[model samples]
Target: MKLARLGSPGQERPVVVLEDAVLDLSSLTPDIDGSFLAGGGIDAVRDAVASGSLPVLEGADSLRVGAPVARPSAVVCIGMNYAAHAAESGSLPPERPVIFFKPPNTVVGPDDAVTLPRGSTKTDWEVELGIVVGRRTSYLDGPEQAMEHVAGFVVADDLSERTFQLEISGGQWSKGKAAAGFTPTGPWLVTPDEVDHRALGLRSWVNGEPRQDSSSRDMVFDVETILWDLSQYMVLEPGDLVLTGTPEGVALSGRFRYLTDGDVVELEVDGLGRQRHAVHAYEAAAR
Candidate 1:
């Protein structure tokens, strides 16, 4: 089933996408916290939806669409997991996964406007497949078991600021990655049964021109392996998201071009749907 959190930023409501209109789900329950997904909330929600026993939704138009899951515990990322993206960034294949974190506050709805942060001249975009974990898992045996813990997937724009990322600092990538408004996720969170994870293509267009394009097939460490690898380090609890990494064609993968204010970025994954964000120049806050 296709699940989504819709409405304006702070006022989002739980919604399920029907063929045309969004099915309001928040009325069935209060905003589901991350712990719900970590526990057995995923199965419960699915069962509820399937049973057609949820409360009738009212105020569907009154509430806004928040991130489908409230604040996740963490937003873990795998850098250069796609070979072509790595080459474009002038890096060699890593012997292991390149992991990083984007704090949970970066989350925003799919169509939210993205700010080109103050002092950031090299704002960039990365369209990635986001995995939301449904169960707690640690020290996973391997990819097979890791796959079992996932709740669903969402499309994400891993908005970036290259100047802060590649320069000025000590090369700690997180400095550029975790800036507020850097991650825009969802139009919907599609269940595993609803998407062909392995076959879907990820494509991104900047100002209507295609920049990055590739398939999940190109991932160096596919979904299953990535989960297993991460579990060995920290427990992945429910509602925690992992950005599986972007395909080639990022501005950093230097056939390079950076974004300017007024540019529009559109990205999509097959079956998962799409997201569009317009970039804007930063204006300093009044003291």
Candidate 2:
């Protein structure tokens, strides 16, 4: 099932996307947040749709689409999970997954404008598959047990500023990753049953020129392994998002020029969806 949110920035209403129309789920739930997902929301929506009991949302096409899911508790990210990306970044794939965090506030709607940081010269783009957790998980035995804890997936762009990430800020990647609107996620949150997460094509383009073209098959640490490994140390709660890293072909590899004002980035994951963002310079007064 495909779920989404529609309306202005902070006033979005939950919706279910059908063939050519969107059905309002506001009658059943307030918003698609952690509590909603944990409380059998998916099943309820499916039942409602199958029974033809949901109301078709009028004027939905006119409303601004927001991130499919509401703010999660944390947005966790894995670094260099792709073999080629690791090589491109001048490193070897680690035996264990490398983890980082992008504060929840960094998340924005897929089509939102991305603000380039003040005095930044190396803002880069990373197209990643984002995992959304559905249940509270801890100390999972292995990857075999990871699927049941996952709710769905979303397309995420892990935007970065190379200078803040590598050269300064003491080498903490999150320092460059946590800027507002840096993480643009979702046109929809697709359920696990609807997608074969193990194998999907993901690609990105800057201003209509392709930069990264790769598949999830190239991932060094697949989705199941990432969840299992993370569960051992931290509790994976409902609505927590995990960015599974990017494939090769990022600007940081010295292959393409960094993003500038007015540049547009388009990214897509085979079954999940596509996203577009226009880059703009950061404005101090807006903060």
Candidate 3:
């Protein structure tokens, strides 16, 4: 029962995370997206915070956390479901799932501030696991019906640029994955009955060092078989956000060196939290 989204960026507000405070889901739902997780809203915020009737989020510790879900309609991704990150990007492990799509306005905010685009030299960093769909999936019938259409789990990064994703704009990888903030997801969203999305634990770091530690149990294709192989084609609505890929130390196998201009990306997964950004240099925002 985590589900955050504090203030700033489109005026976020929804909240819930507790262990000692932060409740107010805006009088019970106004934006956790996908119409509040298809209207169940994590069982109505766990029975309104176990009947205490929610309403504590006063300061929420100086607000500004955003991206805990809100503004999604598709941000799917899944390339190289991690078989050593598909042999370190040279590629070879693909029996199915390798979809792509990252442009739901390139959602940002898990410690936002990453630009590095403008003839970018390769700017990489991945660390994923994000799911979040909760209803309206399509053509399921497998992978245990895609775990009843999931409704939680965050911690994503997927910020690539690798020469606009593989050299030019023809191979088609969301054209180097929709730039802007390049996805950088949430600080919480959690809920699939609490977590254990197939043995979580996917690490990453850049300026602080360690690149990508890896372990969604190596994931050759886990987590309800990538939502039953993306519901056979496409339709996952309800706050859509997939991701589920990155691992095997990034920097595109060159071993390291790509992101520049400050470099600081730190990501984590374990209990679905942790993300930090800091590479800037792209300005251009005066239209």
The TM-score between candidate 2 and the true structure equals 0.98
Q: Which candidate number has the best lDDT?
A: 2
User: How does model 1 score by TM-score?
Assistant: 0.92
Instruction: Compose the digit string of candidate 2's lDDT tens values, residues 1-287.
Output: 99999988999999999988899999999999999989999999999999999999999888887888899998999999998999999999988999999999988899989989888899999999999999998999999999998889999999999999988878578888988889999999999999899899999999999999998989999999999999998998899999999999999999899998889999999989999999997763256
What is candidate 1's lDDT per residue for 193-234, written digit by digit as tens?
988898789999988999877999999989999999999999
Give the lDDT of residue 103 in candidate 1. Answer: 90
Candidate lDDT values, in order: 0.81, 0.92, 0.85
The residue pairs found clashing in candidate 2 are: none
lDDT for predicted candidate 3 compared with the true structure: 0.85
Instruction: Give the local distance difference test score of model 1.
Output: 0.81
Residues 223-249 of candidate 3 have per-residue lDDT tens digits of 898888788888899889898889888
Clashing pairs in 3: none
Better candidate number, 1 or 3, judged by TM-score: 1
Error of 1 at 274 (Å): 0.5
Backbone clashes in each candidate structure, one number apiece?
Answer: 10, 0, 0
lDDT of 2: 0.92
